[model samples]
Target: MTPQDAQAFLDENFAPWVRALDLTFTDLGQGTATATMPITDQTTRMGDILSGQALAAMADTIMVFACFAHYGEVKPVATTNLDTVFLRPGVGTHIRCEAEVVRAGKALLFTKATMFAEPSGKAVATATATFYLA
Candidate 1:
C-alpha cells in the first residue's frame, strides 16, 4: 500500500486516542512500513520526553501496516505479543518508526521495529511483535 493508503487505514481502523497521536505515514513498501509521530504535549510525559506508551503504540501501528504490505492487502490481525525496549530518551521534534515483517506464517506474522528521534536520528526504542492473522 501507498503512504496515503496506510494513513487512511490507520484513520479508519484505530481508536480515537491512537489517532490523536497525529502519526503520519511516510513510506510503505513490500513487507515494510515507516511512520512519524510528532512529539507534543499530548504525546510527551515527564521531562518532555515521548512516553513509552506512545512509542510502543507507534511501533505496533506501523508493524500492522508491514503485515498488510507483506500480504498485499489489509487483513484482519491482532497483536498477540508485543515487547518494546527503550534504548534512549525520546526527545526531539518527532519520532519515526521503521517496521518490517520478519516472517509471515500461515496464522502468525512476526515483525520488528526501530524508533528513532527525528532531527538527531538517535535510536530511542526497538520492538518485536507477534500478530495473529484472523
Candidate 2:
C-alpha cells in the first residue's frame, strides 16, 4: 500500500489509543510493513528510555497490516500472543519498526518486528507476535 493509503487505514481502523501513537508508515509491501514513531516525553520513562509498552503496541499494530500484506486483504485478526525483547535502552529522537510475516497459514500467522533508534541505527528491541485470522 502507498503511504497515504496506509495512513488512511491507520486513522480509520485503529483504536483511539493506538491512533494516539502517531505511527507514520514509510513503506507497506507484500508481507511487510514499516513505521516510524518519534520519541516524545510522553513515551519515555525513568532515565528517558522509551517505554516498552509503546514499543510492544507499535509491534502489534504493524503485525495487523503485515497480515493484510500476507493475505492480500484485511482479514479479521486478533493478537493471540506478543513477545517483545528489549535489547537495549532506546535513546533517540525517533524509533522505527520493520515488521514482516514470518509464517502465514489459513487460520494463524506469525510475525516479527525489529525496532531501531534512527540516525545511529542502533537496535533497540525486537518483537514476535501470533495472530488468529478469522
Candidate 3:
C-alpha cells in the first residue's frame, strides 16, 4: 500500500488512545514502512523520556503496515507475539520507527522495527513481532 493509504488506515482503524500519539507515516517501500511520533505529555514518562509503552505501540502499529506493504494490500493480520527491547531512554522531541517484514509465510509473518530518537538519532528500542495471517 502507498503511504497515504497506510496513513488513512491508521487514522481509521486504530483506537482513540493509539491515535492520540499522532503518528505520521513517512514512507512505504517494499516490505517496509516508516513512521514518526512526537514526544508529548501523553507519551512521556516521569523522567520526561519517551515511554516504552509508546515506543512499543508505535513499533507494533508500523510493523502491521509493513506487513501490508509486503503483501501489497491491507489484510487481516493479528499480532501473535511482540517482543520489545529498550536500549536507552528516548530523549528527543520525537521518535522515528522503521519497520520491515523479515519473512512472510503462508500462515505467519515476521517483522522487526528499530526506533530512534530524533536529532540525536540514537537507537532507543527495537521490536520483533510475529503476526498470524488470517
Q: Candidates' lDDT values, in order?
A: 0.95, 0.90, 0.95
lDDT string for model 3 (1-134, tens) is 88889889889999999999999999999999999999998899999999889999999999999999998999899999999999999988899999999999999999999999998999999999999999
Error of 2 at 79 (Å): 0.4
Tens digits of per-residue lDDT, candidate 1, 5-76, equal 989988998999889989999999999999999999988998999999999989999999999999989999
- RMSD (CA, angstroms), candidate 3: 0.6
Per-residue lDDT of 119 in model 2? 69
What are the per-residue Cα lDDT tens digits for candidate 2 across 1-134?
Answer: 67677789889988998898889999888889999998988899999999999999999998788888777667898999999999999898999999999998888999999999986799899999999987
Q: Cα lDDT for residue 43, model 3?
A: 92
Model 1 alpha-carbon drift over 4 Å, by segment: none
Look at candidate 1 and give me any clashing residue pairs: none
TM-score of each prediction:
0.98, 0.96, 0.98
lDDT at position 79, candidate 2: 95
* CA error at residue 12 for candidate 2, angstroms: 1.3
